[model samples]
Target: MDKIVQFVQKSEHNATAVAIFGAIGVAVVALKALSFLKVLVDVFLRSGINLKKYGAGRGGWA
Candidate 1:
């Protein structure tokens, strides 16, 4: 246990930096995924889109 503690003490700075940046990266990815899921639910599912009329008017993108 003492050897493990000593090793951790030795690498404290590098460990702290890695942990902080890793947490930030994880938070950013989570926020992006949440944003994408919100758009999927709000725009794709909740909004009513008349596909046939839209495709007929807009020329073959159905």
Candidate 2:
């Protein structure tokens, strides 16, 4: 645990390491967002109906 903390502190003191870490963090977040979008697309495709058309239909609890 101490070694991990020391490594983090050392990295924080370096500008290049900080920039690399920031870029890696951004990439991870972007990948997760893209995965969520893919799942949503798959769900939409399986439902076989357009969201706009479904929303316009009369149904309970509108």
Q: Cα lDDT of model 2 overall?
A: 0.77
For candidate 1, list the clashing residue pairs, or say none: none
The runs of at least 3 residues in candidate 2 whose Cα sits more than 4 Å from the true structure, single-residue gaps closed, are 1-13, 46-62
Please give, for residues 3-61, the per-residue lDDT of candidate 2 as tens digits: 75667678556656767889999999999999999999898866665655656555624
Q: Candidate 2, TM-score vs. the true structure?
A: 0.52
Query: Which ranges in model 1 have alpha carbons more than 4 Å from their true place?
Result: 1-10, 48-62
lDDT by residue for model 1 over 1-62, one digit each (tens)? 87756655788786687679889999999999999999899987896767676666666764
RMSD per model, one decimal = 5.1, 9.6
Q: Residue 55 error for model 1, in Å?
A: 22
Candidate that would win on TM-score: 1
TM-score of each: 0.57, 0.52
Error in Å for residue 56 of model 2: 30
Residue 3, model 1: Cα distance from true site in angstroms: 21
